[model samples]
Target: MNQQPLSIPADTQASLLDVLREQLHLTGTKKGCDHEQCGACTVHIDGQTALSSLTIAHMVTDKKITTIEGLAMGEQIHPMQEGFIA
Candidate 1:
């Protein structure tokens, strides 16, 4: 599926976690260990599992950065969240 590109400010740091939390205000992508030791900052970049903490924001500027917030279709819950509850 084709996704829209999310532009990141040039001044922003390379860390995807920081961009999402600070710039985009997507707090669902938690930051456990900024050193990329923990998997808490896991997110999907273009439908693939990505460690936002490790990835640079600028590198993925043209890519789709899917966080926990983007999972839901409006009020509906995403499949991942639903599966976890079951």
Candidate 2:
């Protein structure tokens, strides 16, 4: 479920959450508290949970970003998303 990498222009100044949602159209991550106080927009950056709202797009230019959409392996759904099925 790895998604295609985004090409971040050097002049771009949006947060990782913005790029993930607006640019790539990934809506799994939510913006609960724009101040990074809440864990709503949590995602994996290089395999570790991170607050995407706090990270800038240019800072993660070549990093591997995995959202809820990428948690699954092949046809298997990740357990984190199973709750939505029921």
Candidate 3:
């Protein structure tokens, strides 16, 4: 969640999900349908939810991206992981 802004290479040509999984090694965002139907690869951008599989990596450099890890606080479990353990 405290991740720094990403810099997408100009030559990059992949979906946000690809950048996250392949480049950033963020496997928290899952790919279900790959057709933008299932909500598996869900992430937040600027406090809003978006489908990472459909988003372009280069187009999100200016946005605030929050993955499942972002919702976790040291001792606090993320809601999606364990239904909001406080």
Candidate 4:
């Protein structure tokens, strides 16, 4: 996990998923469909499930975006992750 907050260009027209993967190199969220139909791009935005692919990067500047990569704390796994395993 990154200790510092990511700073994306205000003028960037990339999708939230693109910036998360291409810029920050956080690729845990996969791109299934560019459309919002698939759950592969599902992530938490302020604790609510959202489709990253359908979200604009500039619009989420002040929001807390949580990708799959952000769920774990070093060696500790999140409860949701453990549930998926079980």
Candidate number achieving the greatest lDDT relative to the actual structure: 2
Write candidate 1's Cα lDDT for 1-86 as tens digits: 11445555755565888878887787878889877687789898878998988887777756776787778777899897686458
Residue ranges of candidate 4 with Cα displaced over 4 Å: 1-4, 79-86
Error of 3 at 55 (Å): 0.3
Candidate 2 residue spans exceeding 4 A from truth: 1-3, 84-86
lDDT of 2 by residue, 9-86 (tens): 543678888887877788988888888688889999888888988888788877889998888888999888796465
lDDT of 1 at 48: 96
Residue 23, candidate 1: Cα error in Å is: 0.7
Candidate order (lDDT): 2, 3, 4, 1
For residues 1-86, write the lDDT of model 4, one tens digit per residue: 13456667734678888888888888878899887777888888877888988888888776788888788888999886686568
Clashes of 2: 0
Question: Can you give the TM-score per candidate against the true fold?
Answer: 0.76, 0.82, 0.82, 0.79
The residue pairs found clashing in candidate 4 are: none
The better candidate by lDDT, 1 or 2, is 2
